[model samples]
Target chain A: MIGTFVVARRELSGLFMAPFTWIVLLVVLFINGLLFSSFLYQTQGNVTATLSESMTGPSFWLWMIFLPALLSMRLVAEESRSGTLEYLLTAPVSDAAVVLGKFLAATGFLALLWSSSLIYAVTLDYAGGPPDWPAVIGTWFGTILVSGLFVSIGMLASTSTSTPLLAAFLSMVSCLMWIAIPFLAANIMAYLVPLLTSTAAEQAVLAERMGSVVASMDALRHFSRSFQMGVLDTAEIVFFLTWISFFLFLTARSIEARRWRG
Target chain B: MIEVANLTRRYGALLAVDDLSFEIGRGEVVGFLGPNGAGKTTTIRILAGYLAATKAGRLVVAGHDVQRDSMGVRRSIGYLPESVPLYPELRVEEMMRFQGRLHRMDRQAMRVRIPEVLERVGVQDRGKQLVGTLSRGLKQRVGLAVALLPDPEVLILDEPTSGLDPIQRGEVRDLIHSLADDRTVLLSSHILAEVESVAPRVIILHEGQKVADGKPAELAASLGGGGHVAVEVMGAASAEDMSSLIGSLPGVESVATGERVGIHQSFEVRGEGDLREDIGALAMTQSWALRELSWQRPTLEQLFTRLVTGRGLDELAMPVASGPGAAPSSKPEAGPAGLSADAPVLASGLELSQGPTGPSALPLGTPGNAGSKIIYSLNPFDRGASRDLSKPVSVDAPPEAPAEGLPDGASEETES
Candidate 1:
């Protein structure tokens, strides 16, 4: 356990020390500031509705897709590229600790990025309007869960290669596919079942089955339905945690397999 | 502290280490001497628990099986890799503390040991400098400091002075010499002088297999009668009579006349071992004045060249264990089974050039020749009449045994 913390601490400090990190932070916050102003302008200063829209809207999903790639590209790829990974692996630490520690550091930094937007919440209170406390809390929790999922996928991608740029590209493509695939499957099923089935009743039955499968896999739908509406659903929480744990397990195994390949 | 048995590693049919076996006891500084692509780094990585060997192999470091208990093995040995990799983003002190934490050391102990280790490697002033900003030599020193942070029982350093300048290499060699006391050290180097200055025992690898294992002088003495014994005698007999008499000795192969000063004449007697004692005995019996009798030992460069080319193993008479199936068989006169027919080698192309016989040709007992030149310790086999005196002791001893009763005569004599 101490091995995990030691690695995490070094990785976190390394992230903070890089000028590129600060540059990314500044550009992201600047864009988020514009996003907050545009939402307030569109909603006529309805802070609660604006908060919900900002958390679940298309622009937010785009940021969620790209942010993790930037945060986690160097977690393992840079170490392997610079040859520091040998020193790290030869230390008295298990492969799991190294992978988990890097994942923790990236998730922690994602949480910090989301926390910086609380200034927008304070701005709403000072403007003679206040956000619904439960809804605001739910939105933060939902966004963090989504970011955690993306970061773990990025971590898995990072462990697959030694080039940081290639890792970032692979991570971005995987995140895009994760969000787009279920919706595409649902649309494809709806269109194909109508042409294949002879009777309307049979078509309806197959569509309902396909709908349930799409509903179960569509994480964005669950995030918008439960987390944006001031409700914390236990089923949704279990779903995100399971996927995160699955990816983290694969990342650990990938690191262990490198020794054999070498 | 380290034992490897039939250790083999293959990367898609390119065998990196081919059934290599050697044992290093506690408090022994053994040098791994080999050329590039000789699998020295691969073997060291396996011993350091960094890379996995084939399943048929077994390795133990500090009483822990490397494959079964890699964490224990890692904790007991400190490894400095060939590249000397470090986090360029970290400060030197931060790097030390981070490595210490990985070793599970307490904060208080780290606070004291960090600076002490830095001082030991001669990098105390660079604690506050960023690791990336330091020069290459300083970075190497910082890497050494990190390896020394845990104070491990065994130290495995691979090419520690590869990229450094001459002065820096000397300093690092000196540091290794000081740290070698009471610690089992296994260092790999392609530079002959670096290993010759520090390690008393050497294991030479050629094309990923053991070719020789013994003291530098012992390996030199096994170079198929390449060593020469220089003699200066004052007698009534002519130079040819003395030369023929010396050449008739049991192990003598040839004789070359050196500087002739009136009645006093010098002769270079080439032989299988040191023929100085035999010549002195002959002079005593023949009533000739024996003015000078010095054994000119072969340098390590000569032995390394001969062994790496695969020709020396055929003629190596010393019974150092060279193959995995070799036992402590006490066959002193038989050659090692290390040579294969397909080994790429030029067949014994060394022509015994008479004039330039290397640094060993510098005649001893001349004015100022005592301390100005470094005379490596006398070969143990040189003390006896033939090359087989020390072979029985080395061959009869168990290969995997500890350092309790191993040969230390050459190292001890050099110190005095």
Candidate 2:
């Protein structure tokens, strides 16, 4: 565990010290900050009424997933590409430590990217708008949970090959698919419900039941909608924790396999 | 400190390291020598406990089984890979701390040890400098520093002096010489002369198997290869008379008449042992004033030429007869194993016409010529206005394990 933290510290230092890391952070923050301020302007003096509405939009979710994927894509791939992975894996630390170290660093940056919206939240509160603290906290939770999954997925992609660009491309495709899964499943169910049922009433009931089941399987359902409205569900929390561990465990396995393959 | 048996690593059908076995005791600095594709790096990586040999190979490093307790083995070994890969974002001091932490050194110990290693490698001033901003030579020093941070029981360096300029190379050699006294070091390089200069015991790999493993001098002598001694005599005697006069000695194999510059008559003497004393005596008896007499140690090029003539491992130079279970080819081209029959090389030490045996103007002396030069300690720490490093108990050092208590014959295991 100590070795894992040490590796995390080294990797985190590497990430923050590089110009690219900082440049990417600045650009994403600037872009997100711009969008937040525009939402604030749109809220006008009735900021309390629409704070949750503004935070739950498409741009927030998209940037949360996109930025983390971009950042985490380099986590293992750059180390392998630069030949430092050889040094890293050869250290007395376990393969899991190396994997977790990189994951920790990428996730730290992703969290920073997601939480930068606190500036807008603080501004709204200072201007006499209700703090909407519950919504604010919930959105923060949902954004991080979403970014956490994307970052871990990106990390897994990073380990599959030594090419950073390819890793980034893979992680992007996977994260886009994460969003598209729910929509795809719901659409397929929508198209099939009418065909599978005879009466119109039966079709409506079957569609509702199938839609809820498929929607529950979609990892993002509760977090993006209900959680952003300040209603955190235990099942959504469990889902986030479970899948993050799953991806992180896969990342560790990928790293351990390098010894056998190389 | 290290032992291996029947180590084999195959990249697909190509055998990179084939059934190699050797032993290295503590306080010994051995050279892992070979041309490209001879699996020198692979062997070092395995020894360092980073890479695993294919199953059924037994490797013990620092008293721990490399396969079973790899982390323990890694903790005891300091490895410098062929190209020193460093984090560009890290400062020299940061990199040291990073390695120290990886080795599980205490933070307080790391604080003190980091400076000590940096000082030892002669880079104390540059600890704050980023690794990327430093030159290759300095980067190598930092790499050496990182390796030394743990004060590991065994050091494995892969081509440590490669790519450095001659002066830098010499400095690194001197540094390695200092470190060999108390700690064990195993360095791998394709250049035989580089190994000859630093390591006393050499394990040469030909086509990923041990072709020769012994002291460089022993291998050279057993192969009928040794250096030459040339004398410049200014006298009335003809070159033919001088040649015959020097050739009368038992050991002098052949004497060649050299340049006739004005009144000076030069003769190149080739033979075994130190013929300098014999030639000087002949010149004294004849009352001929000899201007200069120096010996040129037969370089590894001589060894390669003998191999080229099929005197050594002829199959080593043979091209891969065919793929998979076919005759392994030290290939003359497309990498080493496939084309060795034609080029007979890929050996790097041949470039220097004047190799390690040329002359040492510095107080640093070769293994056999200890008394001839002034006392100089290769140890940078012992530099209190120069001290003799010839003491029985020297500092933790260095390369070239003295040829003693070691197997006289290299383990020759055919490809299995």
Candidate 3:
């Protein structure tokens, strides 16, 4: 790990040096803050209820969808464009170390972004009757898991191309498709049962099975639910870590291929 | 120490480097000479471990295998690519420090090494300045300083003096020469003069293959005949008259006028041995008021052209007589005279016009003739003409020829 630290340090320092990172950070935080405040007003001082009812679900999803695009768009894309990738690859560092360092740096940045949303948590505590502290903490945890997953997907996309915009778009598309498959499958199952069945009983049986499958799929959507409830689930943590490691592995392979092609 | 054997790199269909092999001993400053697209950069990149060769080859750097132990090799070698990529926002000192950190150099070592390298490359004062803000020359110096960090055993620099002014180029050359005391330097450059002054041995790459490799003088003498002597006259004597007179002198095989004549007339005398004294005496006898008489050596440019273009000054000096007004008595010897045994004649086969034999026969197609004239050949092999002729050739006349009619024999007597 000394190699990992060196790569991570260079990447982190580069992020600070570039104006794009700060600009993205300010814009993201501004938008997130505005949304949070509007969410507060929509609740009309009932902060705890607002968060549990509507804010937690949508805000968690929003951060999941947007954070990855923001943090990972520059991971491999910027290095490739600036030609620093060559320097890093040629250094006395393994490709895995390079990829891990960059991934961790993006994850750290996402954590920082999540930390900025602590003000919303504070508002809920001060204004509302004793908030569901466990739920609030769970939501934060779920948001981290989801954001971490998205960051990995984004890094994979970034490694696929040298253009930041393309990487962001591809990452967003992949994330949307993964989440949207269950919804699409539900709709297809609903339409197909009416066409295939004659008797109401047969239709009922088919509908029940389809409902079960949809329920299982929906359970997958609750992958971050435990984190939202402030419960540390081994399975959920493993899922996020696994996702991060898988994409990082892919990014490392891409970099290794580049050394041969460089 | 570095060794590359059968190293070939292919980018899709384009072969960037093909079957290249060479070795650089420890502390040897070897200059890499090549024209544009000659694959010099590709070779250096492979050696630096920035690129992996497509076809497997044995590339060892400082006893570490580049393929198996690339990190070790990379740690031991420092590379400066053609375009020095620097973090624009980082100051020179910061960049150096960062590189040192990446190399895992201790803070104390960096504190001492950074300033020393900066001073050695003449960029000590610019350490606080942002790298992007520095001029190209200064940036090059900064790039050199960065590569000099960690005290790497090998330093690979590609086109180090590409955009520098004369003074800066000289400074860089001097710095490279001074560094030769401890480090092995492999530098690629298009500047022939700088390579000559700095590099003791040179490896020339042409179309991805190493065309020539040896000491600069050994390679030059091997490719072409011995050096020639160039005489610049400021008197009334025309280069045509001087060419004929010099051509007739013993030990002088051919006399060709260089680019600059009259106020800057240059006559190249090619032979097996030095003929400086003979030319000086001839100048004195003719009262030609010689402005400059110096031994002209074969430059890296000549060797490079001879390797890449397959032609040298000797081939370019061949007699060219086209339709009509061409004199029959002007044909000179067609074959090159003093070529080393191993030197390959670029355009060996096709024959040009032959001048009739006579005392008045002018060496037609000879590079620089009596008058301030340049002769062109239709053959693609005959090119790379130079006006600088500091090296002279002394010709030995046929033993039966009338000695009384020949000019001064002072220079010729010393030849053999």
Candidate 4:
């Protein structure tokens, strides 16, 4: 355990000192700020009328998608590229601790990026009258949950390839699939006749159920209703945490397999 | 202490290391000597715990099984590869601290140990410089410094003095010698002098097997059939006459002649039995003044070549004088002033060719020449001789060519 902590601390500090971290941070923050400010101006000041309303919507979703690309790029990819992964693996730490340490550090960086948007929250309170505190907090929770999922998925992608650019691309593609496949399935089913859909459903029950569940699970709607309304949902929180764990599990397996192959 | 038994490592179909085994006890400095591609690096890597053996063998480091307790083995051992791997981004001090931390050294120990190692390796001034900014020798010193960080019980270095200047090489050799008071070091090198200087015990590897192992002097004497004897004489007889007399003396197997004047001659006598009494008697009978006569030991070079070439030293000794039938009566008139009587004879039954003369009248081996043809079939050393001495003879004379057309340039070059 002590060895794990030592490795983790050194690795975390290494990332902080690396130029790639600052470049990614500056680029993501600039792009996110530009998009959010543009959206607010386009909405003619109504977008900033309340912190909850401003935080919940496509604007926040854009932040979720773009932030993952930035923070997850170097998680596993840089270590492999630099041959430091071998050094780390040969250390006295367990594989789980290595994956978790890196995962937590990347998540922490993403959280810091997300926290910077608090300036906008403060601006809403000052200019648009007292902001909606419950909604603002709920939206922040959803963003964090989504970021956690992204961090895990990014780690998996990093472990899968030695190239950082390739890892980032794979992570983004997988995340997009997770977000888009459900919507695509729901739209396709909406146009399908009952007789045709029923025949396909018999062949693949799980696929049909997945499509239906994805279609009905309105992430933004749930965010506004439960989280924005100050109503915490056990199922939603559990869902996010489960995804995080599943990807982390995959990352652990990848790291273990490297020892044998390498 | 380290013990490796039947350790074998294979990459695909190539056997990098083949059932190699050796042991180093506490406070012993051992040299691993071998030619390139002879598996020295492979053996070092396995001992360092950097690579696992394909076919596992019993490998113990400081009482810990290498495979089962690699961390313990790592903690107890220090390794420096042929090309040291270092982080260029970090300063020397930073890199040392990081390595110490990785080895689980506490803050207090690291704070004290880093500077001590840096100073021991004589790189204290370069601690603030990035590793990439240092010279090759300094980087090598830093590599040694890092290896010493954990105060490991065993140190394994591969080609430690390679690429260093003479002074730096001496410094590193001295440092390695100084460390003998506490730690066991296993160093590998192709340079015979380096091994002779640092290690008293040598293990010579050839084609993935231990060909020779023992103290340097013992191995040299065993391989050469016996020790060497250096005889310097001040006599009225020419060096050629002295060498011939020495060659014919009892117990003298062979004689190699050096520079000579009217009464000054130097030569090397090699044989299994002592020849000092017989040589002294011959000098008295002939009334030849003997200036110096001392027994000389065989060198590491002779030992190494004998093992690698699988040839006996007696067979390889230069033929100072031909058999009785071929011996010139009263010794043929000596060549130029500086030429030794036992030096290579230029004239032979083989025909000589002509070309632009460089240094001598020797013919560079032509495709159809009998000498070249005979050389190729005789021995490997003969082939090396042809490569070093073969040159096209000049039909047109150049004014700069040395008189007497003797093969003296190469010999003088080596002496200088």
Better of 2 and 3 by lDDT: 2
Off by over 4 Å in 3: A52-67, A126-129, A184-222, B231-245, B256-267, B283-294, B315-416
- Which DockQ values do the candidates obtain, in the order shown? 0.59, 0.58, 0.54, 0.25
Ranked by lDDT, the better of candidates 2 and 4 is 2
lDDT tens digits, residue span B164-272, model 1: 9998898899899999997999999999988999999999998889999988877776654456787877554445667788889998888765544333456777777
Clashing pairs in 1: none
- Of all native A–B interface contacts, model 4 reproduces a fraction of 0.07
Give the C-alpha miss distance for residue A233 in model 2, angstroms: 3.2
lDDT of 4 by residue, B1-416 (tens): 88888987776678777888888898999999999988898787667665667765789988888878877777787777777656556789987887787788989999999999999999999989987688988988998888889898888898999989999899999999998779999999999999999999999998888888899988976677666676766554445677788899877787877433322455778776777878888888977667777776667776787788887664454333332111333232222222334433222211122222322333445533333221322322122222222433222211132223346444333221
Using TM-score as the measure, which candidate wins?
Answer: 3
Model 4, C-alpha of B285: deviation from truth (Å): 8.6
How do the candidates rank by DockQ, highest first? Answer: 1, 2, 3, 4
Give me the candidate number with maximum DockQ: 1
Cα miss at B385, model 1 (Å)?
47
Which is better, 1 or 3, measured by DockQ?
1
**TM-score for candidate 4, residues paired by index:** 0.68
Estimate, for each residue in A5-87, the C-alpha lDDT of model 3 and write its tens digit.
87777667877888877987898778777776676688775666655544355655655676687668888886688776766
Q: Name the 10 consecutive residues with the lowest summed lDDT in model 3 chain A.
A: A215-224
What is the CAPRI rating of model 4's predicted complex? acceptable
